[model samples]
Target: MSLVRKFATVASGTLMSRILGFAREMLMAAALGTGPVAGAFYAAFQFPNTFRRLFAEGAFNSAFVPLFAKEIEANGIDGARRFSEEVFGVLFSVLTVLTILMELAMPLLVRTIIAPGFASDPQKYELTVALATIMFPYLMCMSLAAMMAGMLNSLRRYFAAAIAPVFLNVILIAVLGHAWYTGADSLEVGYAMAWGVMAAGVVQLAIVWIAARRAGISIGFRRPRMTPNVKRLLWLALPAAITGGITQINTLIGTAIASGQDKAVPALAQADRFYQLPLGVVGIAVAIVLLPELARALKAGNDGEAASLQNRSVEFVLFLTLPATAALLVISEPIVRVLYERGAFTSDDTVLVSSILAVFGLGLPAFVLIKAFTPGYFAREDTKTPMVFAAISVAINITIALTLFPRMGAPGIAVASVVAGWANALMLLVVLIRRGHWGHDAPLMRRIPRLVLSSALMGAALYGGAVWLSPWLAPPASLLAQTGSLALLCAAGALVYFVLAFATGGADAGMVRRNVRRGSAAPAGTEE
Candidate 1:
């Protein structure tokens, strides 16, 4: 399959998960609002979720996929299986120990890192600690699942890993539904949601595990040993983990800082969900597919093919994300109000979350560009460079967020993240070019400015449409009216962007067809 098709396979699955995720968040907002329970639950969830990204997505896969792909090429399936089992055994043992340690330290963690501000409220602090302990084991399940996912991706099977996240949303939504039906109190709902997260982790793990089995790789646990391969993996993974989870690190910093303000944690969480939809769909798909594809190309000594994959991945991400950034910036309030302003969620909450979403929108391109550029390093086993840059970005995020939190509140925290993201992304891109690892090819260079122009024009149209449709999007508007109006505005924005994109050759039918077609080579005329 071509890179685009592979991305599409993952993206389609991600889109499903994101849609269901929206439903889950909507129910969560109605159930908890931006109250103490909501803040506690989101804060508690952030710990395990951050670790999941760090261990599973950031560390394991960033380091594992390239190694796994190379293992298959050199040592074949049997070698790959043995290597996987070794890594799995070590991962399982490490996670078990870590979970126990974290559980014991939950109270301290909550008081210090997770949500220091919760310390003043004993009830909220206790709830956060308990919720985090309940969800902490989720890290083990997801890390193991990520290993399986890396194996699947290396084998060029994208659907199962990409689709596995749907179960998380599905399970959570079910828990919220039951809570709503029972008219549960906020505390009761919080406990139920944490358990639901635990259940979802198990379900998600089972999904990827079963998929790995079907792919003919049944990895049984082995005694944890310091084998050469395992040691090498650990070495590469340590830095890559930091690099992979930089966004999570920044968000965690923001979360801890935002925790100082009442309602700020949940408000940031809600805004995060909105931006994460696009990030997960485009950035994640590119990140997942690009690493393995680039590794394979470079392994075969096809430098041209590697460069093409990287360039096209960047192009594809920008093509989709720039428009999304525009929409989020132009109609953030209408979008937030339509989706979230209901039941316990008030209009004031809408205003706060919308502002945060707009700031996150400004960083959308940078977020996805990091995904596009990092494979250039990871594919060559140079995880440390990205790791160094990620650390710098984290420092930037922490300084700016702390400096601004007291004055600008949650939006300031959001701005800090955007700035950090752009810094991380540009650093990676510049290093790649300086090292002669990546180059801005002719097509990519030509298309980006045009894509930016198309998105700007689309944003202007969207702004006008939002103004014209204000009545249908306002308070007291029926849900159907608000949804319809938002949908119409989005459709109009997309039409304007795509028409202009094609007209000015920012994107073209030939490029789309080339991406969708089979094989990796760029056919003549694939680029204008």
Candidate 2:
């Protein structure tokens, strides 16, 4: 299958998960709002979520997938199987011990890493510790699941891994609904949600494990041993792991700063849900496909194909990113009002959260671009450069966040993140160009200017459109009317952007259509 199709498959699945995520957040807003309960739950949940990103999302794929694919290509299935078993043993054992230790140290973890501000409130502080302890084992489940996902992606089996998160969202939404129906208190709902997270993790793991079994790559654990291959995997993974830690550390700092004020943490979490929709669908979709494809291309000494792939990936990301950025930034207020301002969530809350969302919008393109560009380095087995850049970006974030949080609060923390994201992206680009790894194709150079201009045009349109649509999009309006009004606004913005995008040569509907058509004709079961 073409990389475009792979992207489409992964993105389609991600779109479902993101939609379900919106649903889950909407329910939470109605049920918990920006209350102390919501704040405590979000704060507690960050422990496992942080490690999931650190080990599974960021480090594991970069270090494992390329090496796994190399093993398959070089020494065949048996070799890959042996390596997988060893890694599985070590990963499971380490995560098991870590989970147990963290569970015992949950109070310290909550006090130091998550929400030190809550320490003043004994009830909130203790609740956070308990919830975090319950959720800690999820890290173990998801870390192992992520390895399965990497394996499936390397084998060109994208659907199972991509769809796994939908089940997670499905489970959480159901649990939240049950809690609401039972008229459970916020704390009860949080405990249910915490247990539900662990349950979803197990289901997701089983889904991927079954998929792997069907694909003739059943991975089972052996005795944990430091084999040469496992040592090499760890060696390569260390820098990537540090890079991932830097990413999570930035989040931790932002949350810590935001935790100082009431509702700040949940407000930022709401903003995150919106921005993450685009980042997950576009940035993550590109990153997943680009890495293994680039690795294979480089290994085959096919730099031209690798360059072309990189160019189109960047162009595609820019084309998709610009409009999402425009919508999120321009109509952010109405979007938040329509989606979240109901039940316990207030107009004042909408204002603050929307402002934070807009701040995050500024960094969206940079985030996606960073994802698009990094595969070049990861594919070449050079994790150290990104680790260094990530360190520098964290320093920038900490300095700016510390300076701004005193003055501007949660939005200030968000602004720091945006600035740091751009710094990381620019530094990565400069290094790529310097090392002769990046070649700016004509289409990329041409389309970027057009994409930016078209987005600016769309943003202006949305600003005016939002004003005209505000009455129906705000509180006291019926849900149907508000939804319809928001949809109309989106349709207008999408129409304007796509027309300008096509006119300016930033998008090619024809090419994507052809790819889809060809993709439709391919056999479903084959890797190709």
Candidate 3:
């Protein structure tokens, strides 16, 4: 498949999951609002979710995919399968132990790492512990699932891994819908959502497991042993996991800091879910597809093709992310109102969430740029460089968040995260260039400024459009009217950006087509 085609497959699947995720959040807002229960639930959920990003998606994808692809190239299917089974055995054993330990230590974790602020309230603190214990095993399921996902990505089977997350949203939405219909209390809903998260992890893991089986890469049980390949994987994955999970780590810190303020946790989470739409669809989709393809190109000694792939992937990310950042900044209030300002979620909550959302918008491009740039290092087995950069970013995030959160509340934390993200992205890009792993492609250089200007213009248009449609997007408007107005604004923004992008030669259909064709061709000096 072409590179863009692969990206579309993953992005479309992610977009589906994200849309359902929004629905789930909307239901949650109505049921719980930014209440104490909501705070507990989001805090508990964030722990396992952060580990899933750190260990499963981040570590496994960064460390496992490149090695898995190399295994296929060097040892063929049998060797790859053996290696996979070996890693799975170790991963499963380690996760089982880790889950038990975490569950046992849930209370301590809650007080220390998850939410120190909650400790002052006995009800909230115990609730967070119980919820976290129930959900912590989800980390085990998702980590195992990520190993299989890495296998699938290496095999060029992107759909299953990408679409599997939809089940999480599906199950949670069902739980929330039931809670809403039955008029369950917020505490009841929190417990139900926690269990729903655990169940969803199992289902998501099964989906990818089955997909991997169908792809002819069934990995079965083996005794946990540290053979040469397994040891090598561990060595590589240790740093890569940290590097990959930097964003989550930063957010985790922010969450801990924000926990001091009532309703601040859910507010930040709500805002995060909004901006994550573009980040997941564009940044994550590009990263997932780019890594294995770039690794394969480099492994084949196709430097030109690898460089071309990096440039194009970055171009593609900017074309999507720049406009998204603009729209989120320009119309955050209306978007939050349309999505979550009903039921228990108040207009005051909307104002708070939207303000944080706008701050997060300023960092959208940086967040996505981190995704686009990290592969340049990971694809070359240089995980430590990114790891070092990630540590620096985390330190900066901590310092800034601690400094600001006391006075500024949740928006302060958001600012720290944004600044940290930009620091990380710029560091990665600079290192890539200084090390000569990346070249300055003329076309990419030319298009970036144009794309930025196009997004600025689009942002202005969206601001005017929002003002003109204020009545339709405000609280007095019906749900249909609000959603319709918001949708129209988004569509208009997209139209304006694309037209300007193409007219100004920032992007074009021909460029996309060429990338598609280029991706389909075999690397130079390599047989089909």
Candidate 4:
């Protein structure tokens, strides 16, 4: 299989999860809208979710995969399995204790760290505490699940791990949709979703754990033995954890500040749901696949191959991101209106979330580029650099968000995050260049300008398409009409971008087809 197909396999799974996640969010929004119930739930969910993203999608994967790949290469599968068992043991034990502690401290933690703004309302504050406590053990399930996923990705078994997240969305959508249909009270619905989250966590862990077992990489609990390699893994993981932690903390800060404003919490969450669709399918997929591929390339002393992989990953990700960014920027309101304007989700909610989504679109490319580029350092076992850069980005985010929120409201928080995202990406790229890690290849350099041009053309086309489709863009009409309008605008934009890309030789469709057909799946010369 080719790299594209491997990425597609992972991406396809993610695409499904993302699609289901969109459904889940839409259901949740209609059920609760940007009301206090939605606010409390989002705030509570972010508590663990912020940390989950840190480990599952962010630092742990960066630290674990390369080291695991090296262990497999140097010491064979037996040694690698042993390493995984020890790590899993440690992870399970630590998270078990952590979950207990967090559960015990749920109220205090909610009052302090998660959302102090809720303190003014006894009922709201207590509900968030209860909601978060129900979901806290998700930390335990997901921590182990993340390790299992790392094991699977190291073995180039991407599908199950990539698709496991869909269970979460599935559970949530089922619960939320049922609650909505039954006209469950907001309080009843919130608790239902909270418990549903924890249930999904168990199922998510089971899915990946079973997949790893089927792949002959069952990570049973062993004694938590900290060998030299374990130490090395922890050392590498520490900085990456801090980096992921800092970034999540910045998000927490944004949420905390946003929570103070009326309805800002759910507004931001709604906007995040839309933007995360593209980010998940493109950025997350590239990062997960790129990290190990680059690691193996460097391990084999194929610097040229490593550089090429990085460049191609960047090009491929940008090819998707730029146009998506344009569409979101151009058609955010209509998209949000079409998706979430029913039930309790009001016109005011649409306006706020859409504006936030549009600003977030500006940073979308940078967010994905950071995901694509950070692997350059991570693949080389250097997490401290990203840690430093992440700290810088966090500081910038806090300052800008704090400064702007008083003036611009929830949208300002989104804009601050966008600005900080660009700053972080630029910094990482600069460092990668300075350290001689990832130099831009000639192809990358040549094609980027053209990619931008193609994306611009698509953006214009989408803008015109949206203008033409406005009357049919919103409901009080048929769902078919509204969905058809949005889908048509998106398809037209995609058509324009790809047509221009192939016409100008910006992206080689034939090459993509050939490569995706019979080309590098895990790179040209890596162990399977």
TM-score of each: 0.98, 0.97, 0.98, 0.96
Off by over 4 Å in 3: 518-528
The model with the greater lDDT, 3 or 4, is 3
lDDT of 1 by residue, 46-107 (tens): 99999999988998779999999899889988999999999988988899999999999999
Ranking by TM-score: 3, 1, 2, 4
Backbone clashes counted, model 2: 1
Model 4 TM-score? 0.96
Give Cα-based local distance difference scores for all models: 0.92, 0.87, 0.92, 0.85
Which tens-of-lDDT digit does each residue in 7-83 have in candidate 4? 88888989999899889888888888898889999999998988787765565789999999998889888889998
Tens digits of per-residue lDDT, candidate 2, 1-528, equal: 876889988898899999999999999999899999899899988878888888887877788999998998898778888889999999999998888888988898788778998988899999888888888888888899899988888888899999998998999999998988889988898889989988999999999898888877987769999999899888878787766455466777788777778988999999999999999899989999889889888888988878878877887788889899988888899989899999889989999999999999999998888888888898998999998998899999989998998899899999999998899999999999998888777766877888899999999999998888888887678999999999999999999999998888876776455334432222355372
RMSD of each: 3.1, 2.0, 2.2, 2.1
- Segments in model 2 whose C-alpha atoms lie over 4 Å from true places: 244-247, 508-528
TM value for model 3 = 0.98
Per-residue CA lDDT of model 3 for 41-132, tens digit only, reads 99999999999999889988999999999998999878899999999999999999999999898999999999999999999999999999
Model 2 misses residue 459 by how many Å?
1.0
Segments in model 4 whose C-alpha atoms lie over 4 Å from true places: 244-247, 509-528
Q: In candidate 4, what residue range of length 10 has the lowest lDDT sum?
A: 519-528
